[model samples]
Target: MPEIVYAYLDVNYWHPWKIFGSISSVKQLELCLPSSKEYPVGTVFHNLVYLMLCTCETEWLNLLLCLLRDSPKLKFLRFEQYHPIRPSEERPCWSEPSSVPECVVSSLETLEWVKYEGGEEEKEAVAFILRNARCLKKATISAASTDPVKKLEMLKELSFLSRCSGTCHLTFD
Candidate 1:
């Protein structure tokens, strides 16, 4: 079977699990959903290079972590939960992992998180990624409609966190 370079899955919109079997090498996967329910992660896209995602439900973050934990080759990850017009509203929250995923500590090189609000869970996740991702080269976080004061506070806190990679650059937008 030939390796697949791209795959898009959205249970909320389409059921394409049948086609996934033939894909031996998917390099990019995107998931768009009102995803609060768990998706089976038995199939690991080990060759995946980029992952782009969106989740609209409250339980999305935990489910997300469970799903992506096995992708050791993932280099670029983008999580979209930012609301540009409404910063005061709650964004998706990630639970502190009992053990950090290998991707966060090894293969991942760049992380782009959109609509970050600097919430408690957000801080914990950010801190974990920054401190643990040994191979990480850059992290970009964009928060829309956020208060300047809060943004600065978030920046200061993140800046002080110890990152495993000395070359990693943290950027706020």
Candidate 2:
């Protein structure tokens, strides 16, 4: 069998049984969840630098966050969802407020969001990243409702990123 250095799995029948430890050399991984169950967590890609998750469930989001917290070498992350945010009265709480792992912001260079609908949670997510992610060189958000003016407003609200130059591009489709 050819050594699988990198793997990207969508909603397919392929079962994730075993990943080679040699695959620790894997640098990128993408996973899309077709159901609500948690993904296998035992397989560790030590060299993983890029990870993309397109999942609708909160569990998957939590799993991705946990992985990011554990993977010190992770540098890039892209998360997408197909559904609009459902309004809820209560805000979700993190387990550890103070110990919330700070992402390796200096190492991250790019962030991309596709089909995003700006909501309270989504806004909070972006704010958290912008506040902590200091080394991001490029950020792209593509969605139907994300107007250029709104994006500019968001940029203005980011007090931590006062040095960001160049106007962020916005496209409507």
- RMSD, every candidate, angstroms: 3.5, 5.4
Model 1 lDDT tens row, 43-69: 666787798766444545765686458
Candidate 1 wrongly placed segments (more than 4 Å): 10-24, 82-93
Across residues 1-173, which tens digit of lDDT does each residue of candidate 2 receive?
23455677665443443433335466787776443344455555567788787745444546566566655567777877754434552333334334434454546556677765554555566556555565666666655455788755654543334322233232222
Clashing residue pairs, backbone N/CA/C < 3 A, model 2: none
**Evaluated with TM-score, which candidate comes out highest?**
1
The stretch of ten residues in a row with the least summed lDDT in candidate 1 is: 81-90
Each prediction's number of clashing residue pairs: 1, 0
Error of 2 at 31 (Å): 1.3
Q: Give the backbone clash total of model 2.
A: 0
TM-score of 1: 0.78
